[model samples]
Target chain A: MITTELFVKMTIDRWNGSIANVNKHLNALTDEQLQKEIAPGKNRGTYLLGHLIAVHDDMLKLLDMREKLYPELSEPFIQYADKVVEPTPTASDLRKMWEKQNGWLQEKFAKMKPEEWFEKHTAVSEEDFMKEPYRNKLNIIITRTSHLQYHSGQIVLLN
Target chain B: MITTELFVKMTIDRWNGSIANVNKHLNALTDEQLQKEIAPGKNRGTYLLGHLIAVHDDMLKLLDMREKLYPELSEPFIQYADKVVEPTPTASDLRKMWEKQNGWLQEKFAKMKPEEWFEKHTAVSEEDFMKEPYRNKLNIIITRTSHLQYHSGQIVLLN
Candidate 1:
């Protein structure tokens, strides 16, 4: 039987691979290149980094894990065009924030108990919330990874 | 430090949870309810089951473990209108099929070697190909649980 501990570890490792790849790609670019409209009306490089950091923040809340340190996310989410875009953060700042985010999330997953994998929970708001599925902690881990990879494709396309 | 063996175990466990939930849900429904349209358009419970089974068949190929017990599928992909809209599956067959797929996938993952995890491979075509950053073995493992759970939402919404 696959335990929650095993599942969390796999998730953390996969995220490690993904973040490493994205950060490597980001660090290769210059500031001007990061700002260039690779995909107009969508997002540039720096914006994508900020978005990733935002995603990790949400993952923490959803999974009931400890939140990571990110100083740039002070505003509420705004749907800009088809994307819920965040403003650009400096490349260096984004990298530091993401590293911190990933670190804290990893630590949380590492300590989680295997027995709680299937416990179901609902969010406080549903009236105005986008109704999807009722999920547990395990679901949260997998969903965030899927979401990241899907957006990573968008970033790759933007490049 | 996460080895391939550990990832494989995690992948298999996720499949177990998914299959259990889906099958449990499916077994509680009536055959009449199975045929009834859970939503607008032409979608019904049967369509959702068929789609999931079809995708499992596709996912089997994506994992590239071994040949399926059934013959190669020649039918078109199980798709839906509007993407998000769909009907639910019956509770019984959903569980049965869930167990069947999970068992098979786990066995395959266990037999695979650590070195083979990062191997490069090709698919029938670019459109059909499953590769890194999108569709790959690593992804198939990580996303399998979430993918099933996401569709389970579609199944629930159909109710």
Candidate 2:
């Protein structure tokens, strides 16, 4: 009984729900709170936010939707360790990046049709995609949703 | 593309991948490390493992696959907060429970056909399920995979 439309809707609902849950904790953070580590040695809340934004920005290309909005975020936030001796973005700067990237992602998702979700994205070849049909554009979104919520759970430790 | 078979395979792959990532970190943890909080004021690695065990136990019934292997885990691990007055399970006890539960779960998942995943399980009424086909049996697994990894991400902070 699971139609394509219903599948897409369910994915979107969970995606948004996970984001809302993370944002609730994120919005409550003070500048000082953001700088504190989620735990003693783990990455700081601010670093996680920037890392998430960088990853989501990469999703634009991975999902073959569009180019990244913030390619500049990759080095400090994604490539380097949080404890590395380098300058990092302020909590406010990362917050703006997160908001902007997700805002655009939301708009992009809204425009996608159910059928389009089944088509191959940038990652795999047309022939290869046919063999592993589930690795469609929609699957990327589903995987990323989990990735986002995984970090979100860590971020909630700041509460 | 994006047939039900591919969807089921993708879900199973991600579920297994998440478990492997968590287990890689888990296998390396000393007993003392399990007792340590992932971060100060956050749940200990022990609690997260037990909570994951309890939730996967619930998944048995939720997916209509089998009865729970450890019904007792529900109270101390799932229903109650970690700081409650109940006696907690040791790191070894929870580790055994996790292994046993997942071993059975992997076997159970291997037996499921693609069509079975699309059918509604025991939770929803037939009438309501018909209306909202998105609430299929497979959706539970999809959501839980994310739930497992979310906590797994938190637990990895101990490393």
Candidate 3:
């Protein structure tokens, strides 16, 4: 059985590692390259970048233990949904925002208590904490990082 | 362009919410309920949980920025490839591992740094850091969580 300390270390290592990579990828893009859409139906590089920024801002609510910023945004970003996937922040704007938000996250991490890693809170009204305390914090790391990667992949395929 | 901050936050929130829901769903299960295989031709709860844990453990290399563990495990779950779509960790073991790993993760968040979030490392010699910084981290979360949720949904169906 892996110890909780080992798991937590792994989770953060992976989560932060990816965050750094996204910046690296963005820095490599020329403005013109950023502006071009890879395919007819796909989001442009700028759009993807914007979308990611929007995603992080929205998600911060959960970290704050507040309600979701946009409860209306739902699954399947289908064109027909007419759903606002949060306001699309521009790339330049996104970069600044990305840096800022990650800054907050860093502070949050540094201040965390070891016991809090296992501290379980129900994000949904339907959740029962008594029966779910075993669920750990890495759960958040895995979910968030994976979600980013999935969309990033979509962006890559489009390019 | 979406800022990295907002993108990361949104991803984080969505995952937290989903996991909260998943915990609720899992807590609702009874022993008898867990035993019944939703897809008789494939893995049921016993196998699914184990599969998830095993896959997750493997993904830890990327999360922790270490070399891959269990390199001998193969590209997919080859041992059970004939009976299963992929090789998976056993369900009981996986759950135990998940609980332990997740517990550790809570502490990880506390130590996370905004600047560190953007720290980039190459996963493999040939892997392009410029293009795929987020690939390893994102892929780990997306694949494992989706795998769990898909099966958890199946587990729910059994009831």
Supply the TM-score of chain A against the true chain A for every candidate structure: 0.70, 0.95, 0.72
What tier of docking accuracy does candidate 1 attain?
Answer: incorrect
lDDT of 3 at B129: 44
Error of 3 at B34 (Å): 35
Worst 10 residues of 1 chain A by lDDT: A74-83
* Superposition error at A120 for model 1 (Å): 4.3
Best by DockQ: 2
Candidate 1 lDDT tens digits, B13-125: 56666667666666666756666554445345666665667677776666566565433221422544423433334446554665676677667766777545434333545
**Full ranking by lDDT:** 2, 1, 3
The residue-by-residue lDDT of candidate 1 on A1-159, one tens digit each, is 223454455566666666665666666677667665434444455666676677677666666555435534634221332235444456677678777776776676667676554444334344422232224556566556555554554444333
lDDT scores of the candidates, listed in order: 0.55, 0.85, 0.50
In the order shown, the candidates' DockQ scores are: 0.06, 0.67, 0.05
Candidate 3, superposed: residue stretches over 4 Å from native: A65-88, A125-127, A134-136, A157-159, B1-159
- Ranked by lDDT, the better of candidates 1 and 3 is 1
Lowest lDDT block of 10, candidate 3 chain A: A74-83
lDDT per residue, candidate 2, A2-113, as tens digits?
A: 5678778877888888888888999998878998988887789988998899888888897888888888888888899896836787998888888887788889889989
Recovery fraction of native interface contacts for candidate 1: 0.06
